[model samples]
Target: MTAEVDAYLSALPDDQRAALSDLRARLQILLPDHHEVMSYAMPGFRQPGPKGKMVVGYAAFARHLGLYPHSGTVIPLIDCAPFKTSKSGVLFTPDRPLPDALLSQIIATRQAELAAGYGKR
Candidate 1:
């Protein structure tokens, strides 16, 4: 994890911090080649491509955690019935973190989109 991301998570409440940390670990496993960074004022990952840039991000909020798939188009296409979602991101509470399957699907979809050159940096 980057120092900026560590500092950001350190400031969050315990539950939120733990939730985000777990999510970050899962993401790292799924996208091991991606580099962690601070983007859009949140913890983000950039997969090195012909043009390296942020492919996903996550943030802790007072009421929810955010999973950003970079493009507005991607999150809307995800079947997020179990959780709350908007064009920008998926929202889940600390106590009810996103399931591993759902998180994997979201990351896979975003990875596919990026590979297809659908979402530019």
Candidate 2:
């Protein structure tokens, strides 16, 4: 996490703070090699995909903690669609628990999107 991201997360209230933390951990496990950075003033991770690199970002809004896959990889898939996340990324409301299964599917689809972009691999 970048200093900016760190400070930003540190400032969140306890509830949002915990939810964002969980998101950060899961994203890290999903893309361990992703380079962490701050993008558009938000914490972001860039991971290599099949086609190119994929970027995931995070933010704790007043009502939700956003996990941005950035890429459109998971959009068309059904399992991940429940979380939808609009045209942006997944959203977890404060006090609402994070869904591990949904996060896993999102990560997997994002990776596959990158991989498929490269080739049949």
Say which candidate scores most in lDDT: 1
lDDT tens per residue, model 1, 13-99: 999999999989998999898899898899989986656857889998778899998888888878988888999899998889889
Per-residue lDDT over 34-109 for candidate 2, one digit per residue giving the tens place of the 0 to 100 score: 7777777788787654444645788877766787777654645635444436655777676665577777776777
Task: Report every candidate's CA lDDT.
Answer: 0.88, 0.70
How many clashing residue pairs are found in candidate 1? 0
List ranges where model 1 is wrong by over 4 Å. none
TM-scores across all candidates?
0.94, 0.78
> Candidate 2: TM-score?
0.78
Clashes of each: 0, 6
Candidate 2 deviation (Cα RMSD): 3.7
Clashing pairs in 2: 49-114, 50-114, 50-115, 50-118, 51-114, 51-118
Model 1 TM-score relative to the real fold: 0.94
